[model samples]
Target chain A: MASFRSSLPVYATTLDVVWHYAFRTICGAILVFLVAPILVIIPLSFNAESFFSFTSGMVSLKPEAYSLKWYRDIFTNGMGAPEAAFGWSWLVDSWRHGQWMLALRNSVVVGVASTLVATALGTLASVGLSRPEMPFRGLIMGLLISPMIVPIIITATGLFFFFSSVGLAQTYLGLILAHALLGTPFVVITVTATLTSFDRSLMRAAANLGASPLRAFFSVQAPLILPGVISGALFAFVTSFDEVVVVLFLAEPDQRTIPRQMWSGLREQVSPTILAVATILVLISLAMLGSLEMLRRRVERLKTETPI
Target chain B: MTAVELGTEGLERRLARAERRGKLRAFLLVAPLLAFVLLSFAMPILTLVRQAAYNTLVSANLPETTALIADWKVDAPVPEPLCEALVREMHAAKEVDPAIPSRIATFVNRERAGSLSRVKQVANADIKAPYCAGLAALHDDWAQPDIWRALKIVAPSFSPRFFLQALDFRLQADGSIRSQDSNEALHLMLFRRTLLVAAGVTLACALLGFPVAYLLAHVSLRVSNMLLIIVLLPFWTSLLVRTTAWIALLQQNGVVNDTLVALHIIGEKGRLEMMYNMFATLVVMTHVLLPFMILPLFSVMKGINPNFTRAALSLGATPSTAFWKVYFPQTIPGLGAGCLLVFILAVGYYITPALVGGQSGQLISNIIAFHMQKTLNWPLAAAIGTILLAGVLLLYWLYSRLVGIDKMKLG
Candidate 1:
């Protein structure tokens, strides 16, 4: 009987070991599944062939034989290249010569302008909402933030009609306004969280020292809130840049953002140029993400060192 | 004794003055935002919702006729005499504006078509008055099944037909809520598809994010914060760029397949179905949404003391058991909050799936978009949108109930 009881535990222990190994293996495998597609797409962006699949030479282990011809084709326009092998020579030439650059520039311009505008408006709104002295405070904040909760499709539709009525439809100004409106909520949320940690007493101290309210704000308050504002601005910029639905309703073809351009290209044409564009985008995002990380760390450092 | 020191009149007067100044300043500070929201957001939505129920074209053009049939019930085909009245009113409608026929045609076509097409044409032709006489003289077939179909579709009075259609239900000829079959269907497959896709994406985010967040919280703060930003960086760039970047990396000839082939992980003959598939959709969506999950989990995890695990361990529990029983349960609120927010966001997402999902991968929002932009079915689109809004709100309510949202800590 003692042996039977002891043997049962040994069996259970073996089962437990198997279970642990299986669970870890499965979870890690899933993590790979999660991370692989993202990592895999990097090399596919380098394929020399026009087809989405690999050719014999492209997949070979030897790095020496692999050509940067696809990258080159993506960067420069050569008129004399034979059309015999691949169907996308014109696309290759166009992409190489810098037409995509214009689209990229337009996207950046729109993203930047909208972000700046949203951050400014959102900051003012957040400040007003934060003040205890402001009346109907709850109601006003709710109203201001309602835009975020509403369906973007509905917002897009409303913007379409509203802009069309004012003749701002299809204009860059219209797209900017639409993006700004949508992007403002993120700024408000981020800045409000930052403002919560703010010491109202610090402002009073500056005032007691005979600093005017404006000076107190600029000298003392602004520096403390600057990190929040910057984070909010970056969020807004990214929000505007990545937005597609509202842009689809509001932007003309000429005003196509990179997303809008990618959307059209995906729907109308399937090409490696898109892949090239995606790779560049990934690189830019990684760099931006890295910088944002640095900013966040700096903020954390400030929080710990300054006690307030 | 001290209370008696101040003069009552002086204190009251001072209070009144302060109140007046406070009120004025509040107005000054608060007015623009109220005006902005009222004018820019609230007014537009009110107008859109109003249009969704009853559009201006129907009210202004057929006010008299609508008033005549205002009490018409759904027991039978719109009264035959009402149809005649509509035919006459439509004639007058054309005189007011040539666009009435097309407008009315939209409503009528939803029901019977062939019979109603002639009625629309007659209405467009401006054949007014002694309308039965006009109808007889015209000898047009306005009593056929198609005409009734068209007329019924365009019929007035704050009908719930559009709303029903939006939910993928249609008001049958019998006026019952019935499942739409192939022949007479208004499929909300896309909306449901959007919801399903959104759920799947949210699940993926949580599944991947929970472990990473657990690692960050339990591990050293330095490493945790580093991974946190790595998680947040995509959030800083425009989502458009990140999504596009995924496309490049995932495309057939894209980096992933190239690497795999080079490493001989998979044979070179077959290409990975990297882009424009469910795998691509989930991959890009999860990448976009991972930060949302991580941030909330991190904040909640930060608040949880390490002692709970140690206490459990001291009680002779295994480390994994201690962690799961004591630590994981406390993080549920964050998990719920993160999942709700990400799922809600994903449900409404259009761009990522549209670009990466290909034809088979398209979700419901894409259809709603098509209806809004391409088909110009404003009422129908509004109906669909209203349903989507309701679905999101309902899900949020369920989440709040399940998770006790007030307790969820956020970054």
Candidate 2:
């Protein structure tokens, strides 16, 4: 198409080619602007020096200009003596003292726990919501999903006071509940979407075959909807993992997640270690994005392949 | 009645019962989550709103004093009975909870600044008969009608003082609401700034996003999907990481400045202070929210039949004219949804601004957080939060009306 447009003498006027190139140029620049910040951090995270910008040697692509020190720092950052010779004791010390490691643990724990809660409740409610017999489905769904729409700051402040009065503030339970509340919307949206395309007669058929509703769900429905469920769970987990506002209000210093840790790190001190963490997070998001894309394709395929 | 009619009636009753049972089962399935959301999300916001108009620290601690001053005229001097009630209440409160006077002082200070010490001083002063005169002797502020008026306003356990303060209004000594002094008016300005920044970011995102979305929509499926991934990658990345990337890029010693310096756009000594200002906030936010704009726009543009524009062009119209007359109008729904979504998200934005929003860039959310955590002033925080929440909910209501919330998609 490009060659055809450029090859035609009369069709390819100077004005037309200039305008076409200009439009493409602007689009290209905007796309680059969208992804540049994320891409820039990857190479900067590999800088041997602790600076945020590329060093002269690095600009010249010197082999010695890059190092894994920051990535290594992710593990050894808080060790009592990180310079100590490599040994099992150093590894133990790093594991015990590394702040990022602790934050990683907290992130995973909160993410998984909240994802489980959100997925279970959201999936169940979506099932009921998808039913033709369900009452006030729109209003109910709206209320359930308001957490996603409401400004998170308002939610955080509200939860702060509520949790304090109920003795849940500054506890893992408080953080987990807050995250699960935030995450539930994703689960509800995804599971409800999957349910929309579902065939009700399958369940009715299973019932006619003397299968209990639970048995029918596990055998006939769950398998078909598992992609949506897993993808929703992944989203819920990411929501929890990436969340920081609620953590700032509700989490204790001991309960800090990776984002919360990066927050203070960025504020109180700008460190290259943050770049390392950011790189890892970018990679994680890439993996998540890939999985989601795959799951979407799978759901589409399943929808097309099903006779119903 | 015939046996057939009787049997048909019985079957109808059984079917009705079965329908009711199914409805009950569906309700039960939804019940647990409904209860959880109500308990966790809905109830918390309600409590926050309640907190805005609820003030109890002063009244609860000095009940007798509040009652004594409730009917006192503003023009009159501090009555002996009020002073006596205050002293008695203070002593009693100290006996019950040593922290009560301080709490009362804090609450009073919120109304009339610098009066807390006077309250503390009077609370500790030894008074011999003639209570009003003795209190006046202990602290000259005790003789002032303004202190009395401030106390009276908050004397009620439930008062709208915080809400009034949130709007930069205050109760005068004569008990009339008026605008706060210019020097003290912060929240109203913060609210305006928040709205302005949100609008700016929304406009910027729209401008930057429209072209990219148009390109993506016009491209082949494989190319568009790959570009969509490029857009979604940042959308999926941790927000803090993106904000951090901006900081690295925009800081004085960061990549942008370094590049500019190398290119002689600005000398080393003249490096721009870019990181901690509104520019940085707007730039970072637009980047963060661009995907939101693009996705909706892309979806809408993809759905738009290209034939409309082509047909217009084929008939007598130029490409530009056809685009304006046909393509642009069709994308309004997407444009509206994206703009509102970005604006809503931008207004409530806390983390990005907090990280990079130095003094000038901070929004209302930061102030809400400041009061909630730093100042320990929950009521004021609640008031600010209520206002921000109201604005967001209004926009959301509009968005849902214009473009159903059901159509809102996330990668």
**Whose TM-score is greatest here?**
2
DockQ of 1: 0.27
Which lDDT tens digits does candidate 1 get at residues B1-411? 366556776799899898878666546644654565576667666656665677556656777656655555444435556656777678788888887777776666655544445656667554555564556556546433345443444556567777877766767643577665566454466766777788888988898888767766765777666655556555554565566567656777666677787889988887698789877887788888877887888788889988888799789998679878898899997898899889877877777777788877777666677778787777777777666766766766665567543333223
Each model's C-alpha lDDT? 0.69, 0.89
User: How far is A240's C-alpha from truth in model 2 (Å)?
Assistant: 1.2
Residue-wise lDDT of candidate 2 within A43-138, one digit each (tens)?
999999989998888999998999999999899877788989889988888878899888998999999999999999999988898888888877
Scored on chain A only, each candidate's TM-score is 0.82, 0.94
Alpha carbon lDDT at B104, candidate 2 = 83
> What value of lDDT does candidate 1 attain over all alpha carbons?
0.69
Question: Model 1, A46-108: lDDT tens per residue?
Answer: 766665545666556556445565555444423345343555875555444444555666788
For each candidate, report what fraction of the true interface contacts it reproduces.
0.30, 0.76
| lDDT (C-alpha) at residue A200 in model 2 | 94
Q: Residue B269's C-alpha lDDT in candidate 2?
A: 99
Residue A304 of model 2 has an lDDT of 85
